[model samples]
Target chain A: MKKTLALATGLAAALGLGQAAAQVSDDVVKIGVLNDQSGLYADITGQGSVLAARMAAEDFGGSVLGKKIEIVFGDHQNKPDVGSNIARQWLDVDKVDAIADVPTSSVALAIQEITKTKNRVFLISGAASSDLTGKACSPTGFHWTYDTYMLANGTGGALVKAGGDSWFFLTSDYAFGHALERDTGAAVTAAKGKVVGQVRHPLNTSDFSSFLLQAQASKAKIIGLANAGGDTINSIKQAAEFGIVAGGQRLAGLLVFITDVHSLGLKTAQGLVVTESFYWDLNDETRAWSKNFMAKHGGKAPTMVHAGVYSAVKHYLTAIKEAGTDEAGKVAEKMRQMPVNDFMTKNGQIRQDGRVMRDAYLLQVKKPEESKGPWDYYKVLSTIPAKDAFRPIEQSECPLVKKS
Target chain B: MFELLGVPPQALFGQLLLGLINGAFYAMLSLGLAVIFGMLNVINFTHGAQYMMGAFCAWMLLKFLGLNYWFALILAPIIIGAFGILLERLFLRRLYNLDHLYGLLLTFGLSLIIEGVFRNQFGSTGQPYDNPLPGGQNLGFMFLPYYRAWVVVASLLVCLATWFVIERTRLGAYLRAATENPTLVQAFGINVPRMIMLTYGFGVGLAGLAGVLAAPIYQVSPLMGSNLIIIVFAVVVIGGMGSILGSVITGFALGVVEGLTKVFYPEASSTVIFVIMAIVLLVRPAGLFGQTR
Candidate 1:
């Protein structure tokens, strides 16, 4: 009886070992692309970010460490509670390894906290809040595409240097807007520029005539737009109509995207100086990848957020393959250790505070005559190197940095 | 150099002008809603969607047929009004005997469908509509865009003309009579059903006209109406439903109030209208202009 029991136990142990081997060979990696899919920010990040992630997965040979990569997506509707709920579900229930392209600063910050608690990865691409790296930085969160600090330094500094010394801000009244306004105001001040006056407008305001008039009255040399998406488009369009630019007061778009330029068209958006981390037409690599992306996305060029999603996903997968495990902590560590080299970033490295250092560009919206065709919108003014573009690590004020 | 209420004269006058321009839109939209509700006894929740359709149609006309703003101004209303007629005949006609909530629900559902379809086709990014009348006259105090001035004037003219036809004409009397006693009007050998349908169409046409005027000022977007419609509804409520002159006056007055709020306490600009709405509801439940049934 004892001999028979020993043989049965050995058989069970061998079976368990075999099952573990099978699990190692057939692991699955899941990522969730969460953002405002149906609301205002939908045009900037929505389904396009999903398509970009899918492209990244395909480019990464569809798998990492012999595990098939799967992509999932959800619409946060630009609400913090909704975004946090989805992040919780994606982490606890669905076992999603990462969440990417979260727009709307409030939603992104909410998800960032949830991701930290769950020990999951968050690749923030669309949000522009500097606080993500500042006081609220999470070890599990990597701010990928752009941030308010970069925008303020690039566009605000450039505008100040170009003789737009006096400024008035048409700020969108929210966390994102406040951060942008504060950062740009600081940048303007640092460059010896003065902010004469400012007015805060509600988010998604349809009319800007009154706001523009207020800015016009300030007689500030520059009208700094600390807004994004539809708000930016409306303000720029109305500013033109009010002859703010022709009246000799320039407009500086602190967080303008290529998609906004397309919406406004070169005729109305001409000569508007803006800043971004990536432009599709920056080089052959970006153009080729964007062409592939555009083909799948109904001829809409990939915005920096979409490109950032692609780069983040590809880099995350590479990190997973190197780490040889989908354990969130180890994968995040690997991701930070490795340099991000892709179409979107050149030798970009994620800092201890999880801010991805990347080059930012100052771009001027091309005049109608200068644009060759559709999506030909930007005239690259100058490139701010990765080191100079992002906020310095010593000033990040991140809790994680102190621990590290 | 002078300041009024701590704001520069240019800023104050400019905001007031802006407020008036916004008021023009509110007046036009609420006028249409009042006209439709007066006779149809149906609250058209799809008004905003129809308004959005007007802008989209104008854009399509410009893109496909090379129709300019002037052509679109005339043609879009007629085309959209025809669609309104179809809606009244096929769907709305069935809901007359049911609860009024049914009409609201149906129209609301239709708006969602229309907005969804447009979002799918064009995405949410706005398409720019060229300002037909570019450049503004610097009036020393403020820079007044010709296009903005044109919108205010056009909307006012249209609203007044609508009010005149409804309040002062034989046709309007017949329309009022039909609203009061449709069966009696039908007994008098007048086609009451046809008149009701045409009135709804005309009401919808006013919205289309507003949309066309709005295309240049705001981005031509599927969401343009949805955003403006909520504020317009508040204006309609504050003015009292089914009151023509009340809607027109309240809309303009509220816009100026909102503009002043921007100059004084900018944070309250959005909520000032709602605050007034709450006060009006408490003071006069039927609205400033509406009569109790």
Candidate 2:
């Protein structure tokens, strides 16, 4: 009996040393939330994302494999060089296990490369570029939020079906805007619709009178606003003053956040079609989670980017626990193997190309009267399934796909 | 029916008109800058923040006090200008005898602090203000929003009135004399210090009025003034600093030029104003209307 008890103790110690105790590097798991904290994209992703990441850590029992979870954040100021510098410091000096919630595509792409070289996980939630998963897919990068392709598929298809065929585009002149225009233009033309004209405006532009005049001259049935955050809000508000909608030209917001709707108020933003992967009022679970988030966030509801950060961090933590280590490649494999379930996501699956396959909803901005209360902005038009929502495997250009 | 270099005549005409509307803002903003410089011998770098404060004041009045747009139009400037008066007394009054650089540095730092504080209070996503003149008439050339037309007419009146006061009145003469000989003006019992304070307040009032007018066209955001302030400064430089009539004319002309660029190239619209400023500085240095000191 004494020999048996000693043998059991020795085996338990060996297993613990081999697995959980010895594998996690740095004695703690650190996540760096890098995004625009004081620029145009600030309200959309800023400190809300950091808070979401912290909430995720707390929800996951506050630690992984006996290592305390730490969330650190930095403001990228929507600049690529600034974002890359922060990412380098976080990975090399601070030993951050992952970086998440980078918004600007230029900045995210820059950080993606650096994080890949450093062998750290990149859980992108705020950026909209498809290239992160298309041609630039890294083994350690997981695009966990909506992308340009998903936006084009969901909102573009909805508008085409609603009898708004001929389109004009007001594109923000940047990587995300260009990709959205390109992908949506393809989707529009594929549906037997015509693109009449397109004008590229500089990012963070305040005035849209000139651009709106150009679109009004085009006489397209629909005007697609391929921009986000402050730029989107300004264009929409200016469009109303110019009577773009009253003149029978509908504005399609390819990407719109709840915060933007709140900023514009429901009166101006009504009747616009938008695509998003998550909304705070989607279901009971989302409501429970969002209420807590709202209380902590000064009564502001979380944008999809914020929700994605929370979900992705939670999943990353789970994957680390499951894989028994925070090794970038191994944990990434484990994350891809496990299906994601969260407050907003019901059936989320990560593909081999590092894209989070999730259902994006087709939504229409509710009229002021239709809104039941504050933060009640969208009414889901249709449920776009994960398979139909994301880029089909055959069309994927990522090298990770076997092409089978 | 005719096309000029790729753009149709109608489009060209429309864009030029739009340029004038934008120029209205430039004229009003630079007019204030010119007034402060001409009277106080200090470059008011805080003009942009003062403008932003004007818009925020309008927003606060409406959101907190239930005041309408028309009320904001008249009251916002007075309120913000009073705040500007406090700034002048508490800070700007100290650097009157120093080099111009000292004043510029002090004003520039104050502006950053003001902008940063506002940004912290309201996230970068701007708040929307209702349009007072929602209805518009479509001119034959393009869709002409009524607000745009009002902006042009209203600013022209304000500019003329301001120009008349500074260039054609007795008080204007006293102000000019004080700039040239403050001690003599003081011995004449004109209260030169009080005149300087009022001058700063008046200049800041103009910025606040421009902000109230702009609250609808642009979202009431902290960065709105900064975004357009650079262009207005270029207008001031191109018009020649401290020249009242020069600021007004150059403001409208540069605006028309910027509009034409938006129509033809679109990409260069933002840079077109700066390019003209550079060229003007290279050629005339004192500006198109400035007397070389």
Candidate 3:
């Protein structure tokens, strides 16, 4: 009985120490980098996000409050249940104060719920669903980078205005695709264009002949592809084979990355227009950072997701330092109130709805014979200012907002 | 220029023909899965990776070995089949007595490893394989691409030939007997273990062959098979787990249904196959043509 009592006392002391470490810890501020390490999003954000986060930590001098800052990471495997469980573990056991760089929207939504429940901060950098800041907005969450609305408004609105007015969509059949189609369709209508018809293709569809034939038969001026990854590449390639492009119908890729354009080669993907929040060759700073990033990562260019990771991590750390505490509510308030400053971002501000205000660039894929160096795939035709790139705050459906 | 149900004859026929082409792939893949499950009693989860590897093999043969598509079409499956044999002998054979779930887990792990290694080497972007037969013969309503026609015909021949070998041959009789009672087959002085190994190898080769055919149409990538395999699995279960011809028929039928769904209600195009599987389970319990045994 005496030994048992002594053991219980020792356990209580250990528990007390753990609580003290979590609450009044002086040496380290822990941030969780939750993302898909080995799934579809992996190519966009996986190890590169981790490296980018580490670079941010290093840029922050690796320590804050006379203590070191550390990042803990886990692969959610693109499942919401797994992602939520990981977030819970990170918050409760790992004592993570902030989470960043969640790529999958479903996973991001699940994690946002967990973070909101736990009163922990979440900095979403990679996921593109507009719901992050719209209906699912949280006081504890800040969507730092891109979203579907920005993409649709930037590309769709611009393309519609450019006289590719009539559209026939070949969309992937999924939540993301549905959302993109809806947003882009609205943008097209808003810009005085019309959708002649639309066809839903299965996600990761190998063949696009049927869908392409539908688009061709529609005789629409524009063939809008609301898909990503392999589906987009295949549709565009087969469309070329079917002589659809030769028939004078333009192909608009709503969501495309530099990597995909590279894979398709400029010859095939030429004249395709896309909108992005960041590019590696934008300016001197972007080029310098990208050159180092590419050199470290085997000469592969950094996609928007990679750049977002770096910028988001840097901003989150700056917020954490400004707040002087790892508390989510406190840090989130400071994040919104403070101007977001980073190498990739210039005078960006986080709105009350947690949407990070930034410019979106419209790029046209350069032809192979354009006589440029390697990785010079895009020619920036226009830059959509931050205010115009995303849907206005008045149009947002977030319930959290009150019309003052 | 005849119009039917708001779709022109050319467009409707073209969609139907595309549906048939997709059906061929579905039939071939599910047939291989059913054959593998029939004898090995293990769901080859790495079937997709093996399929992807087959395409990569064809690409590599062309890029490095100076071999063309026709040669790679024959040699790639053999090379992939040899790899399958080695995999079955070394790793898969060890799980013969455990719960079949272990085999699924092992193969799932192998799939991740194979896909990861490929992704590490080739990246996630699709690498285009040049179409060996580029031009198409102009049909009345539609232009039938030579590669598309070749794929449909080749998959049909392979599927029918496999059915013949399994249903009509005496060797297949012994294989079926072993599936029923391995100990009895062993007692009859037949090599049951070797048969099991060879069956897995053959099933994997079928997936590899499908991959080679798909390489020209779809870019050669590690992810080429992962998505298709899930739908094929649903096809297998809906067609009755171990029924060979049921899987083949169901695969083609479901593909056509999916294509039609795209034409009518495009929203359900991705989900129509799963919906049909759910319906089949509710109505037939053992599938449309599947037997309970």
Candidate 4:
């Protein structure tokens, strides 16, 4: 009887060793969060993005397939080379199965190239350039939320429809701004509107008096400021001071954030129409989620890019869970096939080309006098359906598609 | 047709005027940098941060002290200039014996710390300053805001005035002589150390003055001076370091070229000035107006 017991113990030990090896083979997933930590995109996706990924991991029970999930993060510094190098290290050495929240489009595009070659999943949440899923589309990449095309179509088209037919563009002279101007111009033209003229200003330009005067002289019905961040806020404010808005033309913000509008206040920003994918105070679920987010983010409301980070990280974890193994190809496939569910988005589906189809919102900044509370700055003018907010699948240049 | 990139007469002139406006700021900032470098032999990386601080100071003065644009126009520079003097006396003066690179590094670090603190406190969003000069005059081709025209004219006058002080005055002669032979100037009991400190303060004060003028036109933000300074550095290099009039001329010229690029290529607008800097470096390694010592 002693000999039989010893043999049984040895067999149990052998079985345990086999299980451990298999677990190592199938588990131990690593993910990377590479984003701008100290540059222009930092405010949108700095340490906050890392925190969101951690939150998602916690919500995922911190383990998948009986294997602990580890997330390593780095600052890409908003440079393409830096982003690609970090991606290479994460994929080759650290073996990160997926990368999330690459903010700058130039950096995001380089990372997409690396991920594609390595067969790793790359979810882009903060990049505003539409080329990510447009001409520069890659199989390994997913543009999770917001793009130039949607912004142009929503803000430009809506304003054009509202008899802002004659337009003057105060465009920033860069690839991003050029794309936005092109898309917005096309949208306005499609809506039977005329573009009077455009003045291209330098990025981060301080003075807009010359551009504003040019716009003023053009006498267009709408003065569309196709810029972002400080440039946008400055142009709009200067325009108001110059009496361009008060004189005749209306101000339309092609790309604006809750923070920018907040900083400008309703007096300067009021009556300006903008388009965004997410607003903190949209619905009961959003309000509740945003309350926590705002509290965590120091009472300032979440920007679209911030909300996108929250949603993309959550979806990525969900995909990893469903895939069982942390193989990039499998997880990406799962992400594409499955519907996305998160605080920022509900009933959202990832198209075959990896565009997250979600509703876009048209919002108007409220008058300061009309505000009931501190954070209540925007009034939702209309809800653009998911189908209308984004370009149709046929317009996409992505080669991979379902058999349908 | 002798036309520049198919641009109509009105459009070309309009871009030219626009370029002149941008060049005005570039010239002023570069002039200040040259003055500081001439006296202290240190590249003020903090110049950008200081310029940003100047804008923020003006904004704060308006918000907290109920100071209007006119008062800020006067007091902002004095306050910031005194701060510059303090910075130099306490910190920069200690580095005079070291390699010039050390001073650059220290200033760079200081800039990072200042920018970081401002970013942390105020967030990345910009605060607007109302235009002090309320109205604009309608030109034939374009409506010129009075404040913008004032910025160009004021910046030019300040640049010229600083050049006059440094190039023409007796105090300027002492400052120049001291830069040439510090020990000799010190032996003459001219108080060279105090003069150096005051020079730095004066240079930084120019940046602050530029900032105050800029507050109404530009959004007051921590990042306002960073990218602008890089271009100004390029402008300085292209104009030849230590050449006041060169900076003013090159600043305006590059601005016009950049404006023209916007009309023609558009994609190269941001990069045109850098390209010019590279070209100027190849043609004249010491810069178009710089002495090749």
Highest TM-score among the candidates is held by which one?
Answer: 2
Error of 2 at B135 (Å): 0.9
Order of quality (lDDT): 2, 1, 3, 4
Please state the Cα-based DockQ of model 3 relative to the true two-chain complex.
Answer: 0.41
Query: Candidate 1 at B124: error in angstroms?
Result: 0.9
Query: How many residue pairs clash in each candidate at the backbone level?
Result: 0, 0, 1, 0
TM-scores for all predictions: 0.95, 0.96, 0.87, 0.89
> Fraction of native Cα contacts kept in each candidate?
0.72, 0.63, 0.40, 0.40
- Answer with 2 or 3, whichever has the higher lDDT: 2
- Prediction 1 TM-score vs. true: 0.95
Model 4: runs farther than 4 Å from truth?
A: A1-28, A135-140, A167-175, A195-220, A241-243, B1-5, B283-285
Instruction: For each candidate, report its DockQ versus the true two-chain complex.
Output: 0.77, 0.66, 0.41, 0.38
lDDT of 1 by residue, A1-404 (tens): 45643454355346553232233222468999999887778889999999999999999987555456899999998889988888888888887889999999988999988988878889999999999989989988999999999999999998899898999999999889999999999999999999998999988888888888888878899999999999999999999999988888888888888888898888888888888898999999999999999999999988999999999999998887677667778889999999999987889989988899999988998989999988999999999998889888888789878644
Q: Pick the candidate with the highest DockQ.
A: 1
Question: Which clashing pairs does model 2 show?
Answer: none
Provide interface RMSD per model, one decimal. Answer: 1.0, 1.1, 2.1, 3.0
Error of 1 at A207 (Å): 0.5
Candidate ordering by DockQ (highest first):
1, 2, 3, 4
What is the C-alpha lDDT profile of model 2 across B129-207, one tens digit per residue? 9988988998888888898899999899999999998789999999999999999999998999888898899999999
Model 3 docking category: acceptable
The predicted structure with the larger lDDT, 1 or 4, is: 1
**Chain A TM-score, cand. 1:** 0.93
Clashing pairs in 4: none
TM-score of chain A of each: 0.93, 0.95, 0.90, 0.89
lDDT of 2 by residue, A301-354 (tens): 999999999999999999998898999989999999999999988778899889
